[model samples]
Target chain A: MTTPALEAKGISKRWPRTGAVLADCSLRVERRTVHALIGASGSGKSTLLRCLGLLEPPDAGSILVDGALAVDQGVVAADRSVRRSVGMVFQEPSLFAHLSALANVSLAPHRVLGLDPESARNRACSALDRVHALHLADRRPDELSGGERQRVAIARALAMEPSVLLCDEPTSALDPLLTREVMAVLRELALDAGTTMVVVTHDLDFVAAAADSVDFLHAGRIRISGTADLLGTRGLDDELDRFLQRS
Target chain B: MPRVLAPLLVLLATMAAAADDGMARLRASGIMRWGCDISGGAPFAFPDPSDPDRVIGFEVEIAEELAHRLGVRAERFSADWLALIDALEADRCDLLINGFEVTADRERVVAFSTPYFRYAQQLVVRAEDRDRFTSLADLAGRPIAVLNGSASIESLRSAGVPPSLIVEYDDSLAPFTETILGRVDACLQESFIAQFFAGHDPRLALVDAAFDPGIYAVVVRQGDDDLLASVNAALASMRADGTLGRILQRWGLWSDAQRELGIDRGPIIATIPEAIGTPPEDGLPWSLVLWSLARAAAMTALLTIVSMPIATFVGLLLAIAILHGPKPLSRFCHGYVLLTRGTPLLVQIFLLYYSLPALGAWLGIPELLTWNKVVVGIVCLAANYAAYEAEIHRAALQAIPQSQWDAARALGFTRAQTLRFIIVPQSWRLSLPAIINDLNSLIKDSSLVSMIGVQELLAVALGIGKASFAVPSMLVAAAAFYLVLSLLADWFGQSLERRARTVGTLPEPIHR
Candidate 1:
C-alpha cells in the first residue's frame, strides 16, 4: 500500500574485473516498513542497496521512489529530484572528520535543501534525538566510540528526512555489545519515525530483530523473500544456507 | 780521493744556493702564479664581466708585463683581497697584484716594489652634497663611510678622527651609494675609484680636498730577496724608459695633477717606510667576521619572518589544487614544481633580477626599482623553495587516512570545507621539518643578494677587507656570525617541530 515507498526492478551491476556483483536484483518496501537484505560476503546485497538508494546507479535497472521513476534503462533522468527523498549509510563509518556530529548531520540539509542554519540545526537535533544520540551530537568522529559514531551516522542520514533510508553493513566494525546497541538505536528510529529502510547486512540477529520483511541474496540475485517470521521459521534456502554457513 | 771530495763539495754548494733563491726556483719551475682580486672593483683587478674565470685590470697588466720581462709566462688567480697576503705567505702564489696599498704594516711580512702610482684618498658625496663638507673636521661626529682597511681609514684615524665617525664597509662602492642615500655623510676612497664611480653616477661627485695619498705597489712574499730585487730592477728600467708612463696612460691613471704638478717626470722618489705596527691591518678580517655574523643573523630572521606566511598560504593552496582542483590545474602546479626544482637557485635569482625587467616591460608593468628588485629577489627565492614545500605538504596530506575524507564527505561537507578543516592542519605537522629546512636554506641563499647589489652581510665584510687589508679578521667575523644565526635557527625549528608533534596528538577532528 501507499504505492510501495521505494522499488527496484531488475537492477544489475558489472564492475570491471569483478563482473556481475549484482544481477537482476529487485527489491520493494512498503511505506514505513523495514526491509532487511541478508546475505554472505560478495552476495551483492550491499550493491543492490546502493543501486536502490541512487548513490551508485545500477548498470541496468528501474528505481522508483514514491511511485516516480528515478532511474530507468541504464540512465538517470535529467530531473531525478527523488534523490532528495533517499539517504544512505556506507559500510564504513564515513563520518566527516572535519566536522562534529551535529554539523555533519546538518550540512546536506543546509546546502542541498537550502534550509537556513537555524532550521537545519533544529532538524538535525530532532534526527539525533530519534537515534538517541543527541547527547553526543557535538563530538567529532575520532572522539566517539564505534557505536556512538554509527548512531551519529544514522542520525546524519535521517536528518535529510528521506522517504527511504539505506544502510550498508552499518554495524560491521563495532564489537558485539556496541553492535547490539547500534542495531537497537536503528530499530528504535525505524519504529518511532516510521521511516522506510532497506538494511543490507550479514548479521542474522539484526535481521530477525529489526526487519518486518526479509530477502535472502545469493550470488547477486534475490533468491527468497517473505515475512520475517516465516523466513526465520523455515530458515534459508539450501544455496543461501550453504553460503551463510561458509560465511 | 781528496781531489774528488773537493769537487763534490763545490757541486753541492752551488745546488744549495740556487735552490734557496726563490726567483731562480720560479724560473726553473716555469710556472708563475699571480694573485688578483675578483670582487668586482674594476680597473684594479676584477673578474672579467663576461667571463668569470679570467681577471682583467691595471694590476693584471703590470703583473703580466713584469713576468714577461723575466721571460716566464704568468697565470692569474683571483682571490679575496685580504686573502692575497696569506696566499703569498703560504706559497700559494708567487706575487700579488691586487692594487695592494704600500703601508708600513704590510712591509713586515711582504716585500714591495717601488710605488708605480699614487692615489689620493678623496671623499665622495652626492653631487647635491658636494658642498656638505669643507674639510675632514666637517665630518666629525657624523658617519663617514670608508672601505674597511684602506688608506682613508688610517688617514682618518691618524688625523685623530674618532671611531664613532667612521662607518667601515666591506664593499668599495656601497659607501658611496650609502652616502647618496643619506645613510652616511660621505665615503672616503681612492681618488681613482671615486672618479670611476662618480663618472657613472651623476648624483655623486668627488670632494676636492685630498685626505691622504694611497701609494700602490706590487707585493711578493717576505724572504723572496731575489724576486724582490728582480721586480725593483724591472721597475727602475720602466721608470728610465718611460714605460711606466705608457702603462699609466693606458690605464687612464696619467692624471692631470701628475702633469700639472710635474710629479710624473721627477726623479724616482721612494716614500717606502720601515715596517710598522702590524703586518697588514688585522682589523679588516675581525670586522669582516662581525659583519658576516650580523648579516647571517639578520637574513635568518628576515627570511623566517617573511617566508612562513608565504609558505603556509602557497603550500596550502598548492596541496588543495593538486588534491581537489580541476585536473588541468593540478597538472599545471605539478609542472611548476618540476620546473622550479629542475633549475639552480642562482639562475632563478638572476632571472628575477635581470629578466624580470623585460618581463615587466612586456606586461606593461612599471619598471622595477632597486628596492623592488630586492623584494622580487626574496619572492623568487621563496617561490623556488615553495614548490618543495608544497610537495612536502602534498605528501603529508596523502599520509592522512582516507577514512578522514570519506567521513567529511559523508557529513555533507563540500570538498573545499573538508580540505580546509580536516586535511591542512594535519599536513602542517608533517611538513614542519621540511619547511624549517627550507627556511634555513633561504637565509643562507639570501647572500645571493650581493650579485644584484644588496649590501647584506658578505658584501659588507668584503668592503671592510678591501679597506683594512685585514681580510682574515673580517672573514673570521663573518663565519662566526653565520654560525651563531644558524644555531639559533636550528633551535627555533626544533622547538616548533616539538610543538607540532604535541598539537598533532590531540584527538579532536579539525572542525567543531
Candidate 2:
C-alpha cells in the first residue's frame, strides 16, 4: 500500500513491422524485492521491461514510480529525475570502450546529476566495492572478463543509486560459472542494500534460486504470477507446465 | 663564381651550336620561327582576350615585319617566359623576342640586338595617396608590391627600401590590385605593364616620373651571327623607316627614350638590365638559402597548424549535425559534405582568395575587401578538409554500436552528453589515422595558396629559382623542409594514437 514502489497499468506496444509485441500487460513491484519475468524468446518480456524502465514508451499505459506519474498514456515523463530513478542494464555489457571502469561508473553522476568529479568518483568506488569489483576499477572494458565486466556494469548502475533497476538478460552473455558469479553479486545487492530489481531472464534456474517472485509472461501478457512453490506445483496451467519442464 | 660560370656558359653554348642548323638552313626552310609566351599580360606578347586564338602584341608585329624583311613568313612557337633561352638553345624556336630584358648574364648566354624599345618602371599608388608615395624612398615603412623577379625590385632596393617591406607577386595584375585594396602602399612595374593592366581602373594612379629605364631586344643562339646580323639589320631599318615607332605607338608604349636608341647601329652599349643585388648564379651560400627556405616552411607549417584544429572541430560539429541534429540541419550538413568534398582544393582556394573579394565588394563587406592571402588560405584549407574530416568522424561515430547509445541514454544522459562522454572519445580513436593523413596532406596543399601570392615555401623558393635559374636546388631544399615537417606530423600523429591507451599500449604479446 506504499504505492507498490513501481507499477504499470495496462501497458500495450505495437511495432509497425511486428504488431502487438505487448498487449495490455500490467505489472507491480514492491520495494526491497527481486522480481523476475520469465518467457520464451518471442514473448515480449524484454519489451515489457523496456517500457517499465522508460527506455521506450508503451503505446497505452501509465507507469508510476514512488507514487509519481513517471509515464502516462505512452508519453514518458520529461523530467530527468523520473528517468534517473530507474536504471537499466543491457544483455551485453556495452561499457564505454575508451573509459576505465571507474570513469564509466562515475560518468552519469558527474554529467547528468551535476555532481562534482571528486564526489562522483567516491560514489563509484563505493559501488564497485559493493559489487566486489574494486580491483577492476582501473581496467578498461576489454581488460575485464565476462564476469568482471558484468559486475562493473552492475556497479555502474548502482553508482547512480536508482530506486528500481531493470536488467534484460544480464547474464545471457556469460557461461554457467560466470553467470553464477554475477548472480551472487545481484543476491548480495538485494540482501544487504534492499535494492529493488526487475529482471527479464531466460535462465529459469536463476529465478528459482534468487528471485523472490516470478511472473510467467506468454502471448504478450503476464498470464500467471507466483512464488517458487508454484513452479513445483504442476497442472495449474499446461502452457506454464510445459515451459517449466523445458527449462 | 661568375668566373667559373662564364666558361660553363661557353660550354653549354657550344653544345647548343652543335644542334643548330645555322642561318643558311633557316632561309631554306622559309619560315622565321619566333618564341614567346602569350599569357603574361598586354602591350607585350599575349593573347587578345576578346579573341583568344589571335595572339597580338607589339612584339608580334615586330616578328612579322622582321620576318617579311628576311623574305620568310613568321610562325609563332610556344615556350615558357623564363625558359625562352633554353627553348632557343634546344631549337624549339629560331629567335627569342618576347619582352626579353637584355640582362648581363643573358648577354653571356646568348646574343642581344640593339635596343629596339626602351621601357622604364612606373610606381603606382592608390589614387587617394598618389602624392604621398611618389618614390621608392617614400615606401620605407610601407609595404610595396611588385612582380617577383621584375627589375623594379633592383631599383627599389637601390633607393634603400628594405627587403622585408617588399611583397612580390607571382603575376602582373596582383600588384595594382593589392595596391588598390590598400593591402600594399604602392606597386612598381614597367610602364607598359602598368598602362595595360591598370589604365582604366580609377582606384590606381601612376607616378609622373618613370625610373629604372630598361630595354627590350631580340635574343639569338650563340655563334649564329648570320641570323643575328639579319635580325639586327631588320630592326635598324624598322627603327629608321619609322615602322618600329608606329608599332610602339599602336601599343601605347612609345616614349622619348626611344630617340637615343641611335641610328642604324650594330650594338648600343650592350645594356645592363641587371640589378646590383641580383643573386649570383652560383654564389649563393647554402646556409643563407636554407635559412630563407626555413622561414617560408614555417609559414606553411603555421597555415597547417592553425587550420587543422579548426577543421577537426568543425568536422565534429558537422558529423554530429548530420548524425543527430534535426531533420533540416542534417540534410544541410549532408549537402555540405557533398559540395566541399566533391570540389578540388585548388579551385576552392582560387574561389576563396580571388572570387570572394569580388563577391564581398558586391555585398558591401569591407573586411572581405582586404582579406590577407594567408587568412584566406587558412579559412579555405580548414573548410576544404573539414568535409573529409566530417566523413571520417561520421564513419567513426557510426561504427560505435547502438548498444553504446542505449547504455548512455539508460544512464539518464541527454544526447549531447552521450556524444561528448562516450561517443566522441571512441570515434577519435577510429578517426586518428585518417585525420593525421589529412593533416600531412594539408601541409602540401598549403602551396596552392601561393597561387594568390602567399609567399609560402614553394612561392618563395620558386621566386629565387626563377631568378637564379637554380630551380632544381631550391625545389630540393623546399622538398626537404616539407619532408621534415611531414615526419614530425607523422611522429605527432602516431604518438597521439598511442596515448590514453590504458593498458600496455606501446606493445603487446605476439600472437603465436
Taking all chains together, each candidate's TM-score versus the true structure is 0.59, 0.66
Clashing pairs in 2: none
Best by DockQ: 2
Candidate 1 residue-wise lDDT, A1-247, digit = tens: 3699898888999998978888888878998889999878788887787677665677898988889888887676545257767777876777756467787678677765678878888898998898888998867678889888888888888888878888888988888899889888888867776888999876776677778898888798888887677444435478756755665
Look at candidate 2 and tell me the lDDT of residue A166: 90
Model 2: chain B TM-score relative to the native chain B: 0.51
lDDT of 2 by residue, B1-512 (tens): 11332343345445435343557867889999898755344556653332333567778899999999988999986533544565465454689788777877678778898778888989888989878877767767988898876688887887888899889985576787689778998998888788766665677888888888998899887778888888899888999877887777666666678888852322323212221113354555566667667888999999999999999999999999999999999999999999999988866765554344444434556344537768888999999889999999999999999999888988999998888878888888899999999999999999877755466887666555533434567788889999999999999999898884543232211110
Each candidate's fnat, listed in order, reads 0.16, 0.52
Expressed as tens digits, the lDDT of each residue in B450-486 for candidate 1 is 5544455565555444333334555676666666667
What's candidate 1's DockQ score? 0.10
Off by over 4 Å in 2: B1-270, B273-284, B503-512
